[model samples]
Target: MSAPRLTLPSPAKLNLMLHILGRREDGYHELQTIFQFLDYGDEITFAVRDDGVIRLHTEFAGVPHDSNLIVRAAKQLQEQSACPLGIDIWIEKVLPMGGGIGGGSSNAATTLLGLNHLWQLGWNEDRLAALGLSLGADVPVFVRGHAAFAEGVGEKLTPVDPEEPWYLVLVPQVSVSTAEIFSDPLLTRDTPPIKVRPVPKGNGRNDCLPVVARRYPDVRNALNLLGKFTEAKLTGTGSCVFGGFPSKAEADKVSALLTETLTGFVAKGSNISMLHRKLQSLL
Candidate 1:
């Protein structure tokens, strides 16, 4: 008989605000960011295998099997925990790659949580998040499944309930290379850290905007178009730009107008991830 399978939502994250404090001696930048989940994202399905071989049935062009975060995450979990079970993984991808939407990192976190459940490893969130940090800076937030105030290369998390708004996100038809953005000599790396708790409103600025806009005209154009409707901002080192509205209808209305010129979607922002909500329902 085929093994029982579990499918979970791998929700995308918006870096609501990203500030680079300074560059560390180790070549990693110290960052302060707020992460919030969108109600929309890709979906991943997993099934256990008796053979100790991790395999991902879904293939991404140019991303090798071992290099894909889903496969790497599975292997990392299996190796770390010394679990004998393996998993067959598949994904229905909707999130754009290199759009600054955290698709790959989200996939990795989903793999970790899914395998942990199926294998009955019983690892806690802290342990899972620690392992996830090794995979990517953004992975721990997805693993923790919360909107957070993240610091220290995006691993240190402080749970904060930010106002959930409806967001219209525009996907520019170009990929933004994060490494390129960070390495650019003109990039801002000196934003002062926020010392107060509950970051003030109007703190949604992303320091990478000027550099990203200068590098990618598509991103600059998207920001310009969306800015007419609301306070449009770039999320992370983005090729995707977003603006929030008071309601879904309002967001959709703007999305309709903007998407006529550029591709985009409307999604409600959530402090709690849709992935965790689904996981809770199963209990």
Candidate 2:
């Protein structure tokens, strides 16, 4: 008999809008953003081990085993919860690294939730999300599995229901370094915060776009090509640009046209993450 195993979707997220209000004393930017999930992403599988040794069987090039976010997340949860069991983790890598699409953070969150379930730790979402935040700023949104209005270095989340639209997302060949983008003197760090509940429509702008577009020609080219079909906007400190369409057919049509010159995909925007939906089905 084999040890129990579970596989979960590690979904990607888009920062629908990102506003950098100021730089904090700690050098972290004060950001206000909306995070919405996409139906498409990587998948992660976990098998339990009673001997209590956390391990990731899948190797990511350039990211060592212990340093991988999935491994770190599993180790963190095991230590924090004082859970005796360990996990063997594997990932079907699909999402591009450093694409500004919350791939790593989502994988970390999935590890936390998966181990929590398989280990029978019975930890609540709040506790899990708090642990996840120490891993990355975007992890809490994945843990909570909802579209959110996020503030305070992307930790403070207020659930929001944004209209789910089909998205055509283009992947630029180059990976944009988020640290480089944030540290650029040309980057906008002073967008005024939105005070009202349910942010207004015209606020769908990412503050990092200008700086990112200037530094990465691939990103700039993607934006220019995708912009021809719809209102293309960068997500977070992006190497990925996305535009919303009313229907999957419309989004797919544009994806087919643009993928000739660049790589891209079409997926429906989701308020509730697919990971949570799968977890719920087991209940």
Candidate with top lDDT is: 2
> lDDT tens string, model 2, 85-155?
98888899999999999999999999998998999999999999999999999999999999999999999
The CA lDDT at 97 in model 2 is 96
In model 1, how large is the Cα lDDT of residue 176?
A: 96
RMSD of 2: 0.8
Error of 1 at 144 (Å): 0.6
Write candidate 1's Cα lDDT for 168-248 as tens digits: 999999999999999999988999889537666965689999999999999999999999999999988998899999999
Off by over 4 Å in 1: none
- For each candidate, the alpha-carbon lDDT, in order, equals 0.92, 0.92
Output the worst ten-in-a-row residue range by lDDT, candidate 1.
Answer: 195-204
Off by over 4 Å in 2: none
Cα TM-score per model:
0.98, 0.98
